[model samples]
Target: MSSSRVRKEVDEALYAFVDRQRPGLLGISEDLSPMLSALDVLLAGGKRLRPAFCYWGWRALGGADGPEIIAAAASLELLQASALIHDDVMDGSDTRRGQPSVHRRFEALHASEGWPGSAVPFGMGAAILLGDLTLAWSGEMFDTSGLPGEVLAPGRPLYDVMRTEVMCGQYLDMLEQARGTGDVESALRVVKYKSAKYTIERPLHLGAAMAGASAADLEALSDYGLPLGAAFQLRDDVLGVFGDPAETGKPAGDDLREGKRTVLIALAQERATPAQREVLRRRLGDPGLDLSGVEELRTILVETGALSGCESMIDEFAAQAHVALAAAPIAAEAVAALTDLTVAATARRV
Candidate 1:
C-alpha cells in the first residue's frame, strides 16, 4: 500500500480502538474525559513512521495486506505516543506539535480551574498517569488487533523486547544527560537503543516475526534497518539544532535548551576551542536561552565542524542503508516503499 493509504488506515484503526475505551472511562468518571482529549491531540501529529515500517516489514515477508495487519501496526502509534508524552514531561517541555505539551496542557487546566493546591504537581501527576495509561493500552491494542493467536504468538517476544529496549534506551539517555560527558560513543549508544531499534529495527522484526520469516530474512532486514534508523536520528539531531521552528514545531534550538547530549553536540564539544567550549558550557541547557544564545550555539556548532561532521555521518549511514536494502531478500514493492521512507525519515524538513 502507498504511504498515504497506510497512514489513513492506521489513523482509522487507532481512532476506533481509542473510541472503544471512551465509554468505560466515562462510566468510571467523567473527570477522565481530558485523558482521551490529550490522547487525541497527541495521536494526531506523528509521521506514523513506526506503523509504516511495521506494515512494510510484514509485506516484505509476504504477509497479505489486510485490516488485521493494519490494526496490529497501528498499535505502534500508541507506543510512540506513550514515549513522546513521557519524554515531554521528562524534558519539561512546554509545547509539542505547535501546541502545549500534555503536562503543560494539564497544568493550564489546573490553573484555569482554581481548585488546585499546586498546578505544577497536578499537571505532572496527570501527565504521568496519562503516559502510563497509553503504555498499557499499547499492549492491549496489539493483543486485540484481530490477528490470529498463532500468528501473533511468534511476534510476542520481539514486541516485548522492543518495549524493554526503548525504556532502557530512555534511561540511558537520562544517564547521558546527567553525566554531561558529551562523549560521541555514549551519545551514539543512546541513539541505538533509544531511537534506532525502537524507531525502526524492532518494529521490522516484530512484523517479520509475525509473518514467520526465516532467520536470514530477519538478519537482512536488520542490516537495512539499523543504519537507516541511525541516519534518521542524526538528521533529527541536526534539525533540533538548526531547523526552522515552523517545521520542527518546537522553538528554535529546543534541543540545546533541553541539554540533549546528541552526537552533534558531542562532536562540537570535541572540536571546540577553549573559549568556544566555555561558551557552550554556559549557554547550553539554559532553559531561558534566548534567540541570541541560540544563534551563538549554532555558530559554535558550525565553526567547530560538528554540523558538517553530523551531515557527513548522515550521508554515510544512509548510503550503508541503501546498500543493505539492495541486498535484502524481500519483495520488490517493499523495497520501493522502504526507499521512499528512508528519504522521508531523514529529510531536511521535519
Candidate 2:
C-alpha cells in the first residue's frame, strides 16, 4: 500500500472505533458531557500517525489487523491525545491545528457564559482531568484488547517503560529550557528520551505483540522504529523554526520562544559566530518577538547551516530505519508502505 492509501485505511479503522465507542461515559451527575467532549476533541482532529504506525508495524510483520490489533492501536492514539493535551497546557500553547486549544476554547466559553471564578484556571483544570481520563482509559483499552492475555502481559512492561521515558523526557525538556543547553550531547539526550521510545518503539512493540509477531520481528521493528522516531522529532524541530505558521498551525518560532534545546539549536550554537550566537541567545526565547525578528532568526539559522545540518541528521536516521525495515520479516507491500510513509513523513516541507 502507498502512504496515502495507508492513511485512508488507518482513518477508516480509527473512525470505525470512534463510531461505536461510547460518545459519553455514563454516571449519574458525573458530567459525562465534558468527558465525552474531550474524547471527541481527541478523536475528531488527528493525523492518526501513532495508530497507523502500530497498525502498519503489525501488518509488516505478517500479522493481520484484527479487532484486537485495531483496538490496541486506538489505545495508543488515546495515549498520544492524552500526552498532547497535557503538553499544550505545559507549553501554554494557545492554538492547535489552526484553532484554539481545548483549554482556551473552554475558557472562552466560560467567559461568554459569565461563569463564576477564574475561568483560565478552571478551563486548564478541566483539560487536565480530561487528559487524565484519556490516559487511564488508554490503559483499560490495552487490558481489554482481546489478544491472548498471555501474549499481551509481557507487552505491558514495554508500554510501562515507554510511559516512564516520556515523562522523564518531558521533565528533561523543561529542565533544559530552564537551565540552558550545556552541550550538544545534552540536547540529543532530550530528543532520545522525549520522542524516540514512546512515539515509535512502544507502538511497534504493541502491534507486534497483539499480532503474535515473533521475537525476531519485534526486534527488527525496534531497530527501525527507534531511529525513525528520533528522525520524526528532528524533522519536527526543523519545522518548528522554518515552517509557515499557516501550514504548521503553530505560531512561527514557537520552539524558539520556548527556548527548547533542540538539535537544531545546538547545531546553530556550535557553528554560528559569536555575534550570531548572541543574537540567538538574546532573541531565541523572547515570546514577544515580532514577525520580522522571527524572520531574521530564520535567516541566521539558514546562514549558520543549522537548518541543512538538521536535515542531514533526519536523512541519516531515516536511512538507517530503511535498512532495518529491509531486514525485517515483513511483506514487500507492507515494507513499501512503511518506506513511503517514512519518506513522506520525514521529508515534510516546513
Candidate 3:
C-alpha cells in the first residue's frame, strides 16, 4: 500500500478508537470530554513518521499490507503522543504542532471554568493523567490489533524495550537540564537513546520482528535506522533554535527559552569566549527571556560555529545512513523507499 493510504488508515483507526471511548469517558464526567477531544486534535497532526517507519519495516521483510498491519502500526502514534504530551509538560512549553499544548489547553480550561486551585497544578495534573492513559491505550491497541499470536508475540519484546528506553531517555534529558550539558558526548547520549532509538530504530525492530525477520535483516535495519534517526534529531535541534514558528509549530528560539542542553548548545558553550559564555549562562533557560536576548544567543551560536558544526554532523550522519542503506540486505524495492524515508526524515521542514 502507498504511504498516503497507510496514513489515511491510521487516521481512521485513531478516530474510531477515540469515538469508542467517548461513552465511557462521558460516564465519568462531561468535563472529561475536552481532554479526549484535545488528544484527538494532537494526534491528528505530526508526520506519522513512526507508523511509516514501522509499516515500511514490515514491508521490507515481505509482510503483506492489510488493515491489521496498519492498525498495529498506528499504535506507535499513540506512543508518540504520550511521549510528546509529557515532553511538553516537562519543558513547560506552551505550544506543540502549532496548538496550545495539552497541558496548556487543560490549564486554560481550568482558568476559564473558574476552577478553585491554581491553573498550573490543575493543568499539569490533567496532562499527566492524559499521557499515562494514552500510554496504556497504545499498548492495548497493539495487543488487540488482530495480528496472530506468533506474528505479534515476537514484536512485543521490541515494544517493551522501546517503551523503557524512551522513559529512561526522558529521565536522562531531564537530568541534563538539571545538571546542564557539561559536554557534547553527554548531550549526544541523550539524543541517541531518547530520539534515535525510540523514534526510528526500535520501531523498525518491532515491525521487522513482527515479520519474523532473520538476525541479519534486523541488523541491517538498525544500521540504516540509527544514523538516520540521529540526523533526524539533529535536524530537529536545529529547527528548535532557528526554524520559523509557522513551519516548526513552535515559537522561534523555543529551545533557548526551555534551556535544553542540546549538542548544538554544548558546542556553542565550548567555543564561546568568556563574555559570550556569560551571556549564555545568564539568558539560557530564563523563562522571562525577551526577543533581543534570543537574538544575542543566536548570534553567539553562529559566531562560535556551533550552527555550522551541527549542520556538518547532520550531513555526516546522513552519509553514514546512505552507506548503511546501500549495504542493507533487504528487498530491492524496499531500498528505494527506505532511502527516501532517510532523506525525508533528516530533511523535514517541520
Backbone atom clashes (below 3 Å) for every candidate: 0, 0, 0
Residue 123 local lDDT, model 1: 88
Q: In order, what lDDT does every prediction score?
A: 0.93, 0.78, 0.88
Residue pairs with backbone atoms closer than 3 Å in model 1 (clashes): none
**Higher-lDDT candidate among 2 and 3?**
3
Clashing pairs in 2: none
**Over 4 Å off, model 3:** 348-350
Ranking by TM-score: 1, 3, 2
Candidate 3 C-alpha error for residue 307, in Å = 0.8
**Over the stretch 124-192, how does candidate 3's per-residue lDDT look in tens digits?**
998899999999989988988889989999999999999999999999989989997558999889999
lDDT of 1 by residue, 1-350 (tens): 89899999999999999999999999999999999999899887888999999999999999999999999999999999989889999999999888889999998899898974889988898989999999999899999999999999988999999999999999999999999997999999999999999999999988988998989999999999999999999999999888988878899989999989999999999999999999999999999999999999999999999999999999999989999999999999999999999988887663
Model 2: lDDT equals 0.78
Model 1, position 322: C-alpha lDDT score: 94
- Give lDDT: candidate 3, residue 52: 81
Model 1 regions lying over 4 Å from their true place: none
lDDT score, candidate 3, position 207? 87
Least accurate stretch of 10 residues (summed lDDT) in model 1? 341-350
Best model per lDDT: 1
